[model samples]
Target: MVKGVILRQFHSLILLLFMLDTFANSTDIQPLRQLRPRLVHLYNWAQRTPDYNVIWDLCCDHGLLGLHLHQATTAYGTHVHLVDQVEPIVDKLQTQYAHRQDGNLSICLTPAEHIRLAKQAKQLFIIAGVGGETVASIIQSILPAIQALPPSPHQQIDMLISPNKHVFSLRRALQAMPFTLIEEEFVSDKGRHHEHMFLRYQPAAPTPPSEVGDALWLPATQDKRIYIDKLIKHYGALSQYSPTAFNQQALAAYQALKHKLFGE
Candidate 1:
């Protein structure tokens, strides 16, 4: 009886080891899950831009977006620069990717405003996962440095930004800038609505629309309607508490958008 019991326990241990090995191998084989829709949208937009020499994933927290871009665009000879203001995060990322032999990745511990752009390089800066006001401030601080660069064949710089809240104000700020809006889209992920715009610094054009482009209203998806409804509710609540001119104006604009989109 004792011999039989020992044999059974040994077999169980072997089975457990086999299971662990299978799981470890499966992790290596399985591709990472698809990125969140907002990240995917940003990635796709950057891919469609006129060839870029460097892509800066500014405010990159975990460097996931930069890593994703690095994996996707390394063959094209594009460099991915991941910048964050925190030193620990940067250190962790540097250590995580230390084994990579490719020279296409860079992890920097610096603020978005102070990042050094390659002179004459076609650049795309992606700033997301933050509030609109902060996004505007970062861009405002960086614009002067970018404007100082000497012109080249690939001097154009593109910025793709997505703000978590106060999108209307961000839209106004972008419209006021010298950049031309290449494309803008409203994307909904996990019931949260986000607006992302691809803008290039090209002078000699009138200001774009203060709101997200008219295409937002033209989309008939339920997600679009849901997003509009959330906006309307949000502004309506703010107007009730503040009753200020700005709140009133914002509320009215959102209500009008709802009426136009849903014929309410």
Candidate 2:
């Protein structure tokens, strides 16, 4: 009886604390409010710098990206745009943020059109889903728009992309462009595996082709290291033309990074 009473007391206390926190926080009116913690981490990291003004969420399903931003108290003033194709998806978006106008949310029905818009100093382009190739093309389109815009107050990344496949190809092309990585993440959300990265580039920090390489090694972070280790261990055994997540190039990228496994 005593243990049951104590457990009830603890639950009540936790509920009280949650209520207090909710009261302390102001709700940003968001239509499709779903919080993805990993993505929230991405936004919080980008917001650390004053110059990244725009946050673009492409291939956004149900506007969950906007939902996550709304939960963050510090992410206001950053123009958050959601992009996805299909009438049903946009229809759902309309149902969600119908009255929002204070720069908290904007809807883009055409992904390519928005990609071609001029990049701003505060712009932060995010393209997820699809393959690395599509992500690269969006970045390519955004570059022209970036050129048309007046010089931003500061030089930072123009895009952050998370492709479903062909990440190796994506990274290789990014190395060739004026993009610098801000953060990379490996997340398993609701049984789905995802690798997301945040990148920004300034024209001033032009990448020299001489320093460019054909392959990119995973950074020495614990998660990336573990990811590489897993891949390298599985590489040789993976059969060709297999319907699996890691492709031949991914296996190759893992092979290239095997040196990192031994602290080489």
Candidate 3:
């Protein structure tokens, strides 16, 4: 398909996410229903679907997202997948949702294992509470796994991976591979600053590979410019903390962003 067609179809799912039927106060999973707002917003962005959206809570302390999925009708229809490396977490998750017996939800013991089961559903892989490099590593590992599968005209992997740091390297990896950045935001959630990029990966067309070009960039989007300016200043200020921390790479990145955004 053409680029325009691919973009429209991908965005169609996002539009669908917002338009989905309401469950009318259906989200009642303990500890998770309290977090519905944050988790749902992230899920919408991940699936890029306004109607039926899938979400996975990869690095969860508990199955917060999954609980909401089982409790909420719209979320249930969205096909929620839970993946974790810890056996205890998965065991608790299975036990927690067992009483409800919601077949819509599935709990997986591992990321790779979950990936196999989720292939049939419109997927949104969520990996948070980890460093950015690890998140990028998981994405890199899945590149070939996704390619190995036979193309199904109707299936796609819609994902949102959030890592606390190493986002710069993650950006580099995305640029190095085939993926389209749909929406990116740097928010101060619960008073802590975070960088979250939501993207879509599909087999229909390859994303135009990008390069950092000796320096990185930060865009000027109203209030965002202030944050970017502060970020540049912060890194520049780091030179005072430790000489090693103030390296050519950091200086170069800061300088490039300053010039690009502020025309300094």
lDDT of 3 by residue, 1-264 (tens): 699998998899877765553333233433444663445556556434633445666766577755555455454376666778789988987776665545667677886533663454465667776787788788777677766656665556656766665555566677766677666655555534456666677444656223222211244544545555665665566655665633345556756765776777
Please report, in order, the local distance difference test score of every candidate based on alpha carbons. 0.81, 0.61, 0.60
Model 1: ten consecutive residues of lowest lDDT: 25-34
Among all candidates shown, the one with the greatest TM-score: 1
What local lDDT does model 1 show for residue 242?
84
- Tens digits of per-residue lDDT, candidate 2, 1-264, equal 999999999999999999888765534522344456556655666556534466677777767655455434234466677777677898888765665545566777875555544344466666766787888777776676666667655545555555766566677677677766555666655544456766666566854222112123234455556655665555546636473654555676566665645453
Off by over 4 Å in 2: 1-34, 50-52, 70-76, 101-104, 114-120, 154-157, 188-193, 207-226, 229-250, 262-264
The runs of at least 3 residues in candidate 3 whose Cα sits more than 4 Å from the true structure, single-residue gaps closed, are 1-31, 36-40, 46-54, 73-76, 118-121, 203-205, 208-247, 262-264
Task: State every prediction's TM-score relative to the real structure.
Answer: 0.84, 0.65, 0.67
Q: After superposition, how far is residue 244 of candidate 1 from its true place, in Å?
A: 2.8
Would you list the rank order by TM-score, best first?
1, 3, 2
Flag clash pairs in model 1: none
Q: Order the candidates by lDDT, highest first.
A: 1, 2, 3
Superposed on all Cα atoms, model 1 deviates from the true structure by an RMSD in Å of: 3.8
Candidate No. with top lDDT: 1
lDDT of 1 by residue, 69-167 (tens): 887887788888988888998899887666542688888888877878899888999999999888888888888888889888758788898889988
